[model samples]
Target: MAAELMRETWSGEVSVVTIGAAKSEGGTRSAMVKIGGQKTLPFLFAEGAIPHKPVIALEIWDIAPLDWPEESTKPYGQSIKDPLAWAQMCVKEFKAQLLCVRLQGAHPDFGNKSAQQEAEFIKALLKKVDVPLIIKGCGDDEKDNQVLAVCAEAAKGERCLIGSAVQDNYKTLVAAVLADGHNIIAESPIDINIAKQLNILISDMGLPLERIVIDPTIGALGYGLEYAYSIMERARLAALSGDKTVASPFICFIGQEAWRAKEAKVGSADQGIMWEVVTACALIQAGGDILVMRHPKAVEKVNKYIEELFIPR
Candidate 1:
């Protein structure tokens, strides 16, 4: 006798969120990126539908990175000196579907760029690149609150994904994104409960759950990758099993985490790129919707891998 295949059914779906607005949508972006709207686990086409393929975003900074080692810096050459040039290089050369711009210069220890400066910088970046953007603030809580607010207003109606409202310091950024008609990134410190709670906190501020993306604070290949993967997998399971509070797409910072691994540093240039590529693939398997990465080679390879996994479903 022949046996029948058994599959688990999901009761809830991941909410769909659209990034960037085009000329038709009252914004300048020439294209938009849509993530989420999954009814099953990652790539289980036989079980359910995966409406969107995971997108890889190249990471650029408002200021040229001072600490990146030679292996990573050699790719962009002098374009890294200017954020506009760097972004254009990523879009035109690498074909990045999205860009993650870090306002690192706004940190007090960095350059201490004023709120207005950051705002203008964002406005200029929007003009230079036509792809959707994910605007991240410098990791200073008080400073981020001030800087992201102004930057959010500067890009109002563009529908960028402005982020990173944490448990203790989320009110300002939440209000900023809500007021500007953009989405917010809810960040938690690698804790599932904290991740869920932060999403609730952000949504309670009058922003709908669909407009929030969860950043579950990921780690690199050798550094707590399993732990972070477990957290993400658990969250995905909960979302599939009818949990709406945590049913949001995930955005993982692959470049920032992968390059920091000692193994990536203690090896050849190819090893470093492979480290990033492997980390990115693993996360996508575990259910990552938006991956913010560096290294053009790594991005090139991962784009191929995504094509392989996404079987036109």
Candidate 2:
């Protein structure tokens, strides 16, 4: 007799959130990307469903990223100076499915560029690329509100995901994203309770649960990565147990955190590459639905891993 197979069942599933709007949906993009809607863990195809493939979003900055380590910036060549070119290269050359435009220039500590300048830059970038975008702020609450509000209007109806809204500074960004018809990323430190609470706060503002993606702040390998992994695992389990407050899709800033680690910053090529790849792989297994990565090679490896995991046996 054949051996019996055992499987676990889940009552709740991750919420499905669509990021871009096509022409038929009143937006100019050629396509759209849908994430989440999984009935099982990362890849347990035999047990449940994996409705959408997790996506890789290449991160690009509005201004030249002089602080970026040479290992990370070496791939982009001259496109670093031009946001449009860099975005195009990511989609065309690197075959990135999505692009994340980080508005670092607007930060007071950075260039301190005006919100209007940032808005125009977004408009120009939207015209240059047809792929969906994730508009990130410069980590400054006050400036993010100003810059993102204008960007929300500039990219109106594009259906971009705008955020990094934390428990304390989410009001202004949340209000603007709601008004502009864009999705929001509810960012929280690597704590399950805080993660759930932030989601509650955002939803209480009248934003539908389907329009939010929870970002439990990522911590790279050897740098509290295990803590992040456990938090995500627990959060996923909570969501699976039918907790609506924690059921939204998860997004990890993998590249940002991974590169911040000393091993990835100054180590040899082998160590740097492996560090990023390992960090990203762990996060994927831990239940990351969207990964914002920096290195093209690391992205390639993670994409390959995702493909293999999603393949039915």
Candidate 3:
């Protein structure tokens, strides 16, 4: 008799969430992307169904990014000064499937810009790109609530994903997302229990589980990347074992964390780009459903890797 293939069966699956609404759906986006709905680990086709392939979202800033290394900003050229132009370049020039607007300028310590300023900037970006948008706040909890609240209203009905709602400061952001008909990103430190707890808290506030994406916090290749990887692996395993609280899709800020490491920022051309590529590829294999990246070259390389992994043989 011929040897037979053995596969482990899973009882749970990731929830499917759709971002962006078309004109008929009450928003102006021309396209939308669906993530999650995986019945197995990332790209484990032989074991279970991978209903949707992972997606790559390019990060654009409302204000010009002054701290980015040259290797990461070279592709944008002159468009870096203008948010609209920069976002358009990402979609039209780099072939980005989704765009994430990081409202770094709203931080009091950064630009001290008011919430309305960031909201208007986001409004302009929505008109410039038809792809889905993810609105992220600066790391400051207080400022994030202020800026993201207005942003949620500005992008109302567009079904954008807004967040980074942490354990302590999720209420305001969660309420804004719920009121605007947008989705929320539940962020937790690299702890599986905390990750699940945050999701539960958001769900308790009445946001559907499907509308939430878990950001378990990322660590760059040499900077505790293994810890991040292990956390994600455990989360996915629990989800597959019928744990609904941790079953939401995972999003990793690959570029942000990767470039934060010295190896990716202060190295020669080869080292700088290679670090980001390796970091992103590792996260993908570790089961990241949505990756927010900065460098276009890194994005392109990761896109190619995803194509190879997702295509049917």
Backbone atom clashes (below 3 Å) for every candidate:
0, 0, 0
- Prediction 2 TM-score vs. true: 0.97
Those runs of model 2 whose alpha carbons end farther than 4 Å from true positions after fitting are 1-3
The numbered model that scores best in TM-score is 1
Task: State every prediction's TM-score relative to the real structure.
Answer: 0.98, 0.97, 0.97
Q: Give the higher-lDDT candidate: 1 or 3.
A: 1
Residue-level error in angstroms, candidate 1, position 237: 0.9
Alpha carbon lDDT of residue 79, candidate 3? Answer: 96
Per-residue lDDT of 1-313 in model 2, one digit per residue for the tens?
Answer: 9999999899999899999899998888889999999888878888788899888899999999978778888899988898889999999999988899999999988899999999999999888999999999999988898899999999999999999889999989889889889999999888899889989999999898889999988898999999989999998888887888899998999888888889887758756667788988998898898899999999999999998987778
Candidate 2, residue 264: lDDT:
85
Please report how far candidate 1 places residue 207 from its true position, in Å: 0.4
Tell me how far candidate 3 lies from the true structure as C-alpha RMSD in angstroms.
Answer: 1.1
Poorest 10 consecutive residues by lDDT, candidate 1: 66-75
Tell me how candidate 3 scores on lDDT.
0.91
Q: lDDT of all the models against the reference?
A: 0.92, 0.90, 0.91
In terms of lDDT, the best-performing candidate is 1
**Which wins on lDDT, candidate 2 or candidate 3?**
3
